[model samples]
Target: MSLEAYIWCAALKLDVCNGTPFRVLLCLADRADSLGYGAYPHVSTMAEQLGCSDRTVQRAIRDLTAAGLIREGDQRYVQHLDSRYRPTVYDVLTTALVTLESRGDNRVTPNRSRGDKKRHPGVTSAVALRTVQEPTYQDSSRELTLVTAQEVEEDQ
Candidate 1:
């Protein structure tokens, strides 16, 4: 998986807060080249990796396409004696394309639209939380206190 692509997708708020779409996007992004285009895999493969149904993968693809995060490219077709199957090709929208289309300003800057501000105003970065201690009963009451690395550092 491309950590940079995942981070870019998350930071840019390109997806609706759904894990499936993000996961599908990540799969495509992982295979994408520098131009943000990649060979499309079968829906069954994506569903297997994401642990979702084929319909769910299709829905996520539709959503991403509608959101302009990805564009359908040339399709590959295999012709058999009695039948032919065509697989879709997906092209992830580059940062430049995303900025140009979504931002409404042809500038290659971060999108800070009102919707983004409303959804993630206070989120500056993602920090992983490690449990220092498990919850326990004290004085016949149960209380859970979660501490993060930032908190530990601050305490020190």
Candidate 2:
């Protein structure tokens, strides 16, 4: 599957996007299927579906681009997947640019008096929670050995 599909899927996991953006992502993926890999369909398709001009689609693409969710290329764009951490393209793109992340163990006390209707000045709440996912666990035997060695040394 193309990277756009993966991006759109992740975006949907958040409950904030509107219908137009949803249609943009959906149609973009459909067109990507026909256009094949490394093919970025013209913005008109999104325009046609959303009943807006190509400029609107352009802006939406720009927003996604600025958000680090996609990478723009020569008259086309790539999903700019973060495959090093996860197999899927664009896995948690938001986390990469996240300036601040507050989690269950690392909670950031919000300045409730500071903003009447705002969350944070620099960080999105969605990214905050995902930050606590922690590091990968790839070597169980190594961890056991290290713990055992530490225990033995401490005993001595």
Candidate 3:
């Protein structure tokens, strides 16, 4: 059980994953180890826990694997009178960087007339104005280009 893995899964953007697939990922993350590996739960168990059908759980797993967000580990096999394949272990892959949108900036502003001074809004207009006027920042993929001023300063 790695808290870090769970937090990372929770912070993922909706564009990356949402709905059933997102829930399935979060469940795997909860059972993951410190290095974001070792999540082996039966499909039936996951279905029961998530209040969905086993087929639904399996579909979610397949979708997640297809998206490269998870990878199947060694297959578990059972030996005895049952002699059946056990639940498969999975590893959560976080190769893609996800950026979360701030709650303050996501709010939809109400439309107002140009000369409408009747609204006595408290700081909402100011925040919306600032957000509208703020310059868009593009993240560079170059390794040598620092994205923030707080990062390591290179000597000339």
Give the best candidate by TM-score. Answer: 3
Question: What local lDDT score does residue 41 receive in model 3, on the 0 to 100 scale?
Answer: 75
Q: Indicate the residue-level lDDT of 71 in model 1.
A: 90
Question: How does candidate 1 score on lDDT?
Answer: 0.66
Where does model 2 exceed 4 Å of error? 1-11, 33-37, 73-156
Better of 1 and 2 by lDDT: 1
Q: Quote the RMSD, in angstroms, for model 2.
A: 17.8
Positional deviation of residue 15's Cα in model 3 after best superposition, in angstroms: 0.5
The digit string of per-residue lDDT tens for model 2 on 1-156 reads: 455454544456445444555555555555433222233555765587679998787777666556544453222133343433222112222332232232333222222243435455556677755765666778455643346777889999
lDDT of 1 at 118: 41
Flag regions of model 3 displaced more than 4 Å. Answer: 76-85, 95-156
- Cα miss at 153, model 1 (Å)? 32
**How much lDDT does each candidate structure score?**
0.66, 0.47, 0.71
lDDT of model 1 at position 77: 22
Clashing residue pair totals per candidate (backbone < 3 A): 0, 1, 0
118 in model 1: Cα distance from truth in Å? 56
Candidate 3, after superposition: displacement of residue 34 in Å? 1.6
lDDT (10s digit) by residue, model 1, range 1-156: 455555556665533535788888888877655446543667889899989899999999998888778898534322212234455778778684465557675322223244554434645333223335556666556577999999999999
Question: Model 1: clashing residue pairs?
Answer: none
Angstrom error at residue 143, model 2: 63
